[model samples]
Target: MVPFRSRVRCGASSLNMLKIAGAVVVLAGAAVFSQQVQAQAFPSHPIRMVVAYAPGGATDIVGRMLAQEMSADLGQTVVLENRAGGGTLVGTDSVRRSPADGYTLLFGTNAFVITPLLHDKPTYDPVKDFQPVSLTTVQSLGILVTPKLNLRTVQDLIAYAKANPGKVNFASSGNGSAQHLAGEAFRTAAKIEMVHVPYKGTGPAMTDLLAGRVDVMFSSLVGNTEHVNEGRLNLVATTGAKRNPATPNVPTVAESGLPGYEAGTWQAVLAPAGTPAPVVERLNAAIAKAAKSPRIVETLAAQGMEVRTSSPDALRDMLKKDSGEYQVLLKHTKTTLQ
Candidate 1:
């Protein structure tokens, strides 16, 4: 048996250990509680949303609209910052390097998934570097041809392209833009060869297309609506799987001739990877609410955008799926950035 003094020391040591353990538990619980509180009170400050394109563009316009509505829903200001360059690489890399505190977000587009595939070396990984918050909208592209081309439908365009081969040229917003990808997809699906004429932006590309400098273009419906309505541009087929509500008379590429041929632009909100789950959830909820707002819905509809929101997981899955699809499409089309 131990002596009384030894027994007392052992008891005290055990008691001290218990106290330390208890304190550790309490501290850990406090830390967790503090984190919970912080997450709950997220956006305690203004959030900066990075638009990966220049101002006065579709992404910027849609991002601003969504930011305004989300600010109201989140009870905090969401500022827009344009960091356009490298085909959205500059802004995307900026967001990738930002703190995952939910204060910085990226207004990502289909380019987010396609740009990396176009480049031989990319600065960031879309799926790994960013946490998807929500998908904002999907904008369909109209297959516009110069009326002088006499391409009445997608079939007519395909037949003419097959007959003409490399003689048929299509204009795109840029070399690796969604417009370019859509044209490439069309080329692959239709099994035809067409020259790709890349311009600085949609304005220039549309100008060339309207001037009959280019025979065809896969352009945003919003941008070509007026031209199509005025008969300056012919709407051969839309790039969406279904007819756009704004132009129900226009059939989709799938409905026209090429089945499973759907290509269009999309915009989604994403936070840097490693953002807190609660913060992501909060932002997603705000986005969902904003997407459902009557004014937002109406405004997006007017711009030829269909408002569509998805959960974080859904958005992540979408990015992965789209990335894979783009890889295959790019490979098949042999599309490389110049």
Candidate 2:
């Protein structure tokens, strides 16, 4: 029952309200766009690469190498922070719960994927919680026994372990570590019975192995290559499929009468979910360059690691494949969290 002029005026006011709302929305969107653009200029400040190991471990070594090279490539300081505990769960969980701004990253190892399978309540889901940046390397495992063991080769160790059964004990870097998984895989494949003694870190594990507190340990050659060459430890077998050029005389587990046996460790870079795609690609490219550098390649080779420059998509697929296989292995191994 309003007048025609009043109706027209009301309609005009409603149209103005709509226009104001639209303008506000556009302004808010612009603000967000500007913020995102600012974020895309990543590494504006120092970037932290969290390594889940002590300073002297292979993980820390690789992390430092990447950090030094990445800092140069990104034109910012890239620092390594050691978070050694909970079988790498501590540092990995830190990255998982951190902001997704691409500044905080994780230098995750094979244990990162295998930890959840070995534990009852894993803090993060490998596939769901983070995005794979790039695969850094395939780190071969070395099965080293104490000099006092008097075992000449892997076959001898397996036969000895089988003959002795539960009396033989092997040491691992920690519970739910790749070292632990490697030892378990060997036990299952060789059908040998051995008790696993878990240490807080690889340093302690290697210490005990040297003191004969433990019989044997499957460790990365990065920290033990010198000792092996010095004859302080006996090299039984390597977990790689072929002989590593670094240790040309060493035989593979497959070659040591355990056909179809292959287990190894690896490392990759990951960022929290929700990081920008462009930034992820940039980071991937930087890592690819760093990992492929001749200096890094030669250094890693000496440590018995092979460089693998996988794309983000490729790394994503690798995660899926590895996670599926780990699930099967976990079920078969009957590995349960305590």
Candidate 3:
């Protein structure tokens, strides 16, 4: 009889100990969940956003707009660092080799996607080296000339270049840049010949174009608008699929005797591959929100850009398609960087 009672008491004590252990396990899980919550907050430190072009360019403009908005959204400082060189390769490579944390990011353009096509050996792979965050905006290109040139239309420029041949020099930011390719593509499509004068950067190129040292340039509509309006530069054909609302009367390249010819600038956000999917989603959400802001929309519209926000997957798809198209264009046209 004493043994039966003692055994029943021992069973109850064991059950109580099991409950205690389960409670401890629950507390431990709560601690883990709290830590995960902190981690998901993201951007715990200052983020370095790389702009792969010199300041004052279209890429820089978009990057600054996004960095400001992202800083506000993420509750951290977002710094825009310009690493301009090698047709944007220098900055892009820096981001590619950066740690996979969300602290480092790249704000790039169609030039980044098309640079590899012009080089014999690229330093980094576009699809493999980076993850897309969002597509920010698409900008149309305008053909601008110094006021001294007195050029009116694309036809006038073509006639002048055809007559002068190598005498007419056009300025480009750098070799293999979107401006460079746009200039070359226009010359090829229109069957005109113009000497390409590659500058270390667009600032110098624009300076030369404004000083009448260079005959013409294919510049993003953003940077050239004020100059055109100030009568410092002459407006010519725009290189877009259709006429842009900012300059509706300006004929598109395709409509201006070169049918099917289209070239324009675009901007996108990217992060180092292996960044957490949650972080990417957070960044994308912030970007899409900022793009819809009336201030941002009006600011970019004033600069001749259309705000086009897209999901990360959509941006990836656009980059992939553009990469293939650039490769084909390079091969068929025998384009190369010098």
Q: Each candidate's TM vs. the true structure?
A: 0.83, 0.89, 0.87
lDDT of 2 by residue, 1-338 (tens): 46988999999999999999999999999977866686578768999999877677777878898889888889998899988788788888999999987889999887788777777665788888998899998867999998897997998998898788898988876777888888888888888888888766677788888888999998889868888888899998899888877888889999999998788888899999877777788889889878778888988888788888788788888888888888888777766544
Angstrom error of the Cα, residue 65, model 1: value is 1.5
TM-score of model 3 vs. true structure: 0.87
Question: All candidates' lDDT scores?
Answer: 0.85, 0.85, 0.83
Q: Candidate 1, residue 208: CA error in Å? A: 4.8
As a TM-score, model 2 comes out at 0.89
**Stretches > 4 Å off in candidate 1:** 1-31, 148-150, 159-164, 198-204, 207-215, 302-304
**lDDT digits (tens) for residues 298-326 of candidate 1:** 86686577999999999999999998988
Better of 1 and 3 by TM-score: 3
Task: List candidate 3 stretches off by more than 4 Å.
Answer: 1-39
* Clashing residue pairs for model 3: none
Give the poorly placed runs of model 2, Cα more than 4 Å off.
1-32
Winner of 2 and 3 under lDDT: 2
Candidate 2 lDDT (Cα, 0 to 1): 0.85
